[model samples]
Every structure is written in structure tokens, then in C-alpha cells.
Target: MATAPLKRWVKPEIYPLFLAVGTAVGLCGFAMARNLAANPDVRINKEDRAAGVLENYDEGKRYHDHAVRRYVSDAKPEIMPGINKYFSSSK
Candidate 1:
């Protein structure tokens, strides 16, 4: 019987590379899920649309605006006054 060819040796670093990739993907998925749960109106799932469970365009827009306002206020409360002044001046 003919002997089988020797198996090629793979780099040991490849295992850690796979692990890092998996960790990144997992963290991304978790973050996405958390965001989706926080803002259900911004859903992009096909099933949600087909089942008529998703928000309408206007509702989604309003929700997005609200989220932006919240984020801006939380991250930089000083900016809110400037933003308000700018809008009032524009009007």
C-alpha cells in the first residue's frame, strides 16, 4: 500500500488570528443587538417589515432625531444651547 503524503504544517499564529476575528464579530453582534433593542423603530429586519411590525418612515425619522438629541445632550450638554441658538437664529 502506498504511504499517504505528509500533512503540511500550518502556522500556530493562525489559531490566535481566528480567535481575534471571532471576538470582533461577537462584540459587533452584541453591540448591534443592544442598539436595535434600544431603538426598535430603526429596525432593518426583513421579517419585521413583512409582518408590518416596523415603524413607518416618519416615525423612524422622529425616533432617529430623538436618539440623536439624546446622544448629543448626554455627550456634550454645552452643544445643546448652541444648537438651539442656531436654529432660533435661522428661523
Candidate 2:
């Protein structure tokens, strides 16, 4: 009779310990599954775009240098006195 009453009390204590263990196992399984199911399609194409930009910059620098040389080669020296007389007379 005494043993039967003791068994009843022990059963209630066992239930909470089982519940705690079950909760921990469930949370761990969920995390593992989520990690395995992550995305795999993300990527960056920076190298190709950077190569094109560098090519364009080199071409632009060459073009600008040629234009500057041509302008300097064909430039005429101004007669400052004539320019000033023309503007002063016009006003």
C-alpha cells in the first residue's frame, strides 16, 4: 500500500523531466533543418563590369589627350592690345 502511493508521486515528477528533454530535442532539429534548406543562388558579377569600365576609362584618356594636343598645336597667340581696343571701342 505504501509503495503504490510513492509510485503515483514519482510519475508526476517524471512527466516534467520528459517534457523538458522533448522540447530541447525539437528545437535542435528545427535549427538543423533550417540551415540545410538555405538559398544557393546568390552571386556578384563585379569583375566583368569592372573590366569594361577600365577599358572605357583608357579610351577616354587617349581621346582627351589627342584633343588637347591638337588644340595646342593649332592655337594662335592673341594680340591683347587689339582685343582691348576692339572691346573698348565697341562699348
lDDT of each: 0.67, 0.62
| TM-score, structure 2 vs. true | 0.32
lDDT of 1 by residue, 13-71 (tens): 67788899999999999778857775655456777657766446775656567755777
Q: Which ten residues in a row have the lowest lDDT in candidate 1?
A: 1-10
The C-alpha stretches of model 2 lying farther than 4 A from their native spots are 1-10, 39-91
Position 27, candidate 2: lDDT: 89
Q: lDDT winner among the candidates?
A: 1
Model 2 scores worst on lDDT over the 10 consecutive residues at: 35-44
| Clash pairs, model 2 backbone | none
Q: Per-residue lDDT for 1-91 in model 2, tens only?
A: 8899879777866998989999999989875664444312211356644554343556455544665587877656665867776888955
